[model samples]
Target: MSGLVLIEPTELYNILNQNTIYPCLSDTNFLLLLDARNKLEYDESHVITAKRARCDGEENFAIPYDAELECKTHVIIYDGNCRSLREKCRALQCANRMATDGSKNPVKILRGGYEDFSAMYPFLRTQKIIYLPQELDAISTYPCEILPSILYIGSKEQATSKAIHKDLKVQAHLNLTKSDDVFFDSAESEKYLQIAIDDDREADFGSHISKIINFIAKNREKLRTILVWSDQGISRSAAACIAYLMSYYKWPLKDAWRHVKSCKHTVRPNRGLVMQLSQYEESRLGSKVTNVDDPYY
Candidate 1:
């Protein structure tokens, strides 16, 4: 929680995703990503929109544009392949300089730095440096990353995108829509599941909760990532993610719902599904753990 925080490649990728919980990175002046590598390496390619940070390999760092470092909510720095923050690595030097200059939170050093992040999120790597707000807003959207590399929730369109499938290598697709709505070829060892339910509160979705949990849990190790989605991805699919979290972690419905909703603000399971999940808490955990009638939701 103090000093430099090491962030994984998957975690950074989630924050960079356009369709994830946060607005596009370009839309906010609250994030600053500094590339601590040499000018030649930085000019070749770096993380998208990463600004070059001039470092003297010792105690000097010159940030670009005199960016209001005090205003950024998140500050991340990376170099070629620095592995640990304890070492006097280039990234650590850059991060230390930023912290000294007044970063609110501990400057995060991307684990394994540029090499790992760029390799894991290849689609996000770009040669372009300057970006207009409108240009970023018009960029393609990916699924909301719920559990880093493990789970994602998105729209049907996102589920069908070959680019997303290849980039994320999502091996399991859970479709929480009509039964006849088949979208993927399931090639490359990918698996698919259809929940076949309407978004209506009266739909008999309770029977499938256990199956949903089982499918994801069973294939979790074999898959790169699991993608769950409905036509629009805000209702039934969101509920499915909540159910999986509750079952997997044994968390109460309230806690699970809070965690999921925190990851994607757009997630809003219908009243009927909420009631079913509340009931599941009692049946599975043998105790009533959530107040379904509470107005907090």
Candidate 2:
């Protein structure tokens, strides 16, 4: 699990906002905080102190939910309106489960969300901000200089074109006859890619997931905005399975979904499986869940 679940927003705000009174309880121990905002938003502002949950494609390995810690206190901060924060919080809940029993760690969110945190803690603005220019300079910014967008080719390819028809910064195209194998290879080699195969069924792809995670972990600084398009077509089974596993780590599913949706890729979730995932989150990590977003550990 990546985060915990809590109902009270005020309590969480107290724990994170007023660090002077609450104080970071850990002594000679490290605190791991996750900011589940996109790179652009994170650059503008964030609070997680030790390490932010970076793009899985950019990160080489899953930052163990509970590894090498003298303390269990971990915080997850997310943007309120953004569903990614909630999704990420859910992941933290899963990670906490894989940790030791009788753990006293706390998982919290900020009150009033990202904007409120920025008011109390002003330093988050410079971390990784992205600014859009009013006009594009051909000499300064060329078509190929920025990240290449994901191109989708499926039965409903035309639908995807309409999703991003007006957005020129990212390109989305369709090719109906393309094969999954070919698409996977091309995306891996050409564009930033993160493949999430169900460990339960597609164990064969475990090595593949590991290899990619390792690559991202080692080269996190160079990668940005991963392209997620599964070869599992027309079957929500694969998408749901992948989303479930990806959600296990509290990844920003919205980013992933938005990326796919822009290409008109579909997501079909299993009712039973999705329910099971939610149940697992609530039962396992409910202890540490808080509604506050603590930017720095």
Best-performing candidate as measured by lDDT: 1
Residue 55, candidate 2: C-alpha displacement in angstroms: 3.6
lDDT of 2 by residue, 109-162 (tens): 444555655553343333532222221111111011111222222222222333
- What does the lDDT read for residue 175 in candidate 1? 87
> Where in model 1 is the C-alpha error above 4 Å?
1-3, 18-23, 56-59, 179-182, 185-190, 221-224, 258-265, 290-296
RMSD, each candidate, Å? Answer: 3.4, 19.6
- In order, what lDDT does every prediction score? 0.80, 0.35
TM-score per model over all chains: 0.84, 0.28
Model 2 residue 270 lDDT?
37
